[model samples]
Target chain A: MAVRNRLTGERTHVPSAVGRRSRVASGPHDRHHEIIDAALELFATIGYSGTTMAQIGDRLGMRGPSLYKHIASKQELLVEIVTGMMDELLRRQRAALAEGGDVRQRLSSIVAVHVQYHAEHRYEAFVGHREIDSLEEPHRSHILDLRREYESRFRELVQEGRGLDLFRTSSDRWSSYAILDMGIGVSAWYNPSGSVTPDELAATYAELALRMLGAERGD
Target chain B: MAVRNRLTGERTHVPSAVGRRSRVASGPHDRHHEIIDAALELFATIGYSGTTMAQIGDRLGMRGPSLYKHIASKQELLVEIVTGMMDELLRRQRAALAEGGDVRQRLSSIVAVHVQYHAEHRYEAFVGHREIDSLEEPHRSHILDLRREYESRFRELVQEGRGLDLFRTSSDRWSSYAILDMGIGVSAWYNPSGSVTPDELAATYAELALRMLGAERGD
Candidate 1:
């Protein structure tokens, strides 16, 4: 799986001006990023219910109610974090689809994007997988809708392969589920400090995924 | 996938009557089962740390200290629940292996056993997957050993398929991971009340698993 430039987004590092404003204006965007980072770490370690605003505030070197100044409630915080993660995933998927490639290449690109996203943003992936039900009605539905769209990309690719007589699987839906499950499982055990880079892991997983769907390698 | 007895052990559900001297032990075995049942539900819902002995006691209509009289510690409770679940899995895996079938049949049987075990024992499976790491040292290692042994059964089947020329996949390890991940993922979202029975889901998953390994039917 080739790493496409489109898959790369702007680095999240704060600029000098933004850093100065973070100390002065108490910017919503800066506070939003802080809340997300803190929530991600807490959610990963203690899970959703086990984490609280007090604990999140402790991590941010602020008091409990100070967190409310930035975010409304714990459920709201959860929705924001989950929605942010899903939105990023949607962004990556769109970028992968937009890049110039054949069906096989595009599918591989999608797998790579998924693997890389999960590996680099494991906290978000964990929250996404585990805490979806914590969101309220509209937010929950919106996130689930985005997730369905993300999954449809893989299903469409599988159908394309079937159209080319490359895949003879019984059900495309389950095939897509299997592939997505494998990709998501990467977050549970993948260690960046290990031998394989995220790109290499993505490549390995993409190859396996293609083989699972009976896609032949195009020389 | 035939439900054959393979473990070569006593299939008898011997109710342990040794520890019923306490007031909490009207029927030691029944009470023990009840404790495990409640623990599984609480662990799956609120997670390990979020669950307390007090909550467990309240759920069972007993006090906190009473629970200690039955199980030594919360850690012990976790170990007992996980061990019971793993033991059942081992039994199913042995049965699948002992059915004396071809590579494809054996592989399907293994997948079926895995999915069926999780589907039938959803609470146990959920606790085993999510709260396993919360177990302390020796107990943790014990469960890990059993899990490795269980995984080896499937790995051996994959190797057997490779030796029999039934698999077209390049990497046996990846193939095994894919099948195992698919089975474990089933536990995360499977609803017994849904349209598909555990047996049907197992059959579907097994078919997909075999296809992923490039195992042709009847091969």
Candidate 2:
């Protein structure tokens, strides 16, 4: 069966292996990454449900058949985008924790990094927050588990801070939620081009997190 | 022009005033309010772009033509839902401020009420936050102005608190954003059926907000 390319309107019998390999041979980078980027841009802008495969193809100057050669489905793109973001976040957070500070310093570092990530990578953050419900099945459960693990870092920091008498919190769980939520909210409005730089916003949020946890001023 | 009712299998020449009046005669309430409620639920659950007038009519056991009698269009429903929420929030916040206390007490009352509103009216909050971008023209600007006016309340409190030496904040602007964002986040995750009651959540956040401002514990 002949398939008409959505972008160029050219007829292709199918997504040929030669066609896929030839596209990458002409460029140093793989088409898979490009496809994901286009999908992410569309998903973040028009929303997951509002976007279509044809639009993603149109964005990339690729036909529908060729686009499928790189991605299994739109849902796959969402899964890739969300899961990729979570993995990177977990990796960065672990590195921040490993650099090691006292509880106050450690919490401040993590909060700063969290705020910075949300501000710098606002599109990814927006999609992850908005399209979590759009994720399907095992990917949905897996991403949620990863998120819970990420949140546990904050919870543990608060618990350790409280134990050391450095942080005064009425409830450890709620305090952690408040800190994380405030940072997450940054993505909704933070502009890198604005007066406040990402680093500056991160530092401001870090101080706010410490205050919310009731850390002593002298400490 | 004849139109088919999406809900009930009937033909209506047009939205009849007598038909519209008869529906309300059976009850003491207006269909306009009920239509808004159904639209709110659909907008919050599916999304503004994803929801349809037919689906809203189906939710209310009314037909499309009759539904049109109560609302001008889907955009009108959105404008009402979002503007109504902002108006109600402004009213409640003004009342909270009017029942004034010291800076700490006033801020606490406002934060508590903010959290409570988000927790209890989660759907309205969700729609307002998610669908703000979907708003059109004059309504979009109108709602945003109302939001700015509402946010000014928080900024003013922080400014007042700082002036009186009751609150210590690194940046008055950042501190207010943190407090408001944290409370707004509650709408995304708060569960009325959960072990934590709305009042409990509000009180916890209020304390957090106070601490964030660096209010003295003794006060």
Candidate 3:
């Protein structure tokens, strides 16, 4: 079977029989995932710069040295958290766009997706925003490309909406930035313990996003 | 003579002779400012965690150890950069509000001051946002309090506007957060070599802030 990712155009081919085993989850792999989750919490709270391998391992009840056997380094975890979210965001955004609605419907879906992703992965989003400069080499450029691509999706939506005369703005690029920045800010302040649920916040932001583009209220 | 800081509400007594002569500045003080300017650039580029005192010193003309004579520690520089900005922003925001206009006019002025401050002090603003968690206890709480006060100014404006029927939003607090976040983001991406000036960008944001509140266009 051959499959192509709709957004990134990444393709993978898997023999039907070989692909049937569900990628063979193992103890090591499961532990790796746990380590990444722990790492995300530490990195988000203390910052990637301020966090250390020992602290990440301690959070998982493992020794610092043993963590090296499971994960390469703190940088590896940083790469995983940052890249995973961008890729997932691109996936969800593409899926939303594929639903195929009018500009307003699509815009609402996009806003919802943006807010939901941020709320769901607050730590990853926080680290991804604040720690970009900490990333070295090709990884840095790769993530930056993904971010640009993610943001460009909204810009394209604005451009198409403007073309249809459904949206109004003096500058498409700046307006698009303004819209994205507002939703993006949710990740920074969103808290599970807070009164507002992700769904409620997303809904509120969707309405506000429409208003930002000059859409009438209750329309 | 006596003096009071309008932004911070600090009171001090000043002997006219004691305060006289020195707005011209001194070598040590000037060097300290230069070091801060240098720190801002390095911290923004390298990520505060990755940047070292040696690197900061390298950015200036001094050797790493020699740099200690000018600035106490990297943490000292961080504190100076972050708090100086919070103090300055509060001052500017208070100044704008002091102008005293209609609700819409006051909101516009607040937005303008926010964007303009962020743009002019891009590196400081970037560090302030990204490095908060890197700070230790008392400093961290102090800065957070200052940020709270800064944001409360916008919240008060939103509340007053909502009271006047000039601003419309379900949650004044969240909407105020959204408005401030949008302008705070300008610091991250605003480029001097870019097409627009800070004043122009602030005007655009001021209008956008009004739109996000569901205000009538050109009203």
Question: What are the Cα lDDT values of the candidates?
Answer: 0.80, 0.86, 0.83
Stretches of model 1 off by over 4 angstroms after superposition: A1-35, A52-77, A99-107, A136-138, A156-165, A216-219, B1-35, B45-78, B98-106, B134-138, B152-170, B215-218
DockQ of 1: 0.29
**Residue-wise lDDT of candidate 2 within A178-218, one digit each (tens)?**
99889888887877788998889999899889988989765
Clashing pairs in 2: none
Predicted complex 1: CAPRI docking category: acceptable
When only the first chain is scored, the TM-scores of the models are 0.84, 0.85, 0.84
TM-score of 3: 0.86
Runs of candidate 3 exceeding 4 Å displacement = A1-29, A216-219, B1-29, B216-219
For candidate 1 chain B, the 10 contiguous residues with the lowest summed lDDT are: B12-21
Give per-residue CA lDDT, model 3, range B11-54, as digits (tens): 54443253334547565447678788888899888877777788
Chain A TM-score (model 1):
0.84
Q: Give the best candidate by TM-score.
A: 3
- Candidate 2 chain B lDDT trough over 10 residues, lowest sum: B12-21
Question: Clashes in model 3: which pairs?
Answer: none
DockQ of each: 0.29, 0.53, 0.48
**Residue B137, candidate 3: alpha-carbon lDDT:** 77
Query: What fraction of the reference interface contacts is present in each model, in order?
Result: 0.40, 0.60, 0.58
- Name model 2 segments beyond 4 Å from true: A1-30, A52-69, A217-219, B1-30, B53-58, B61-66
- Residue A54 lDDT in candidate 2: 85
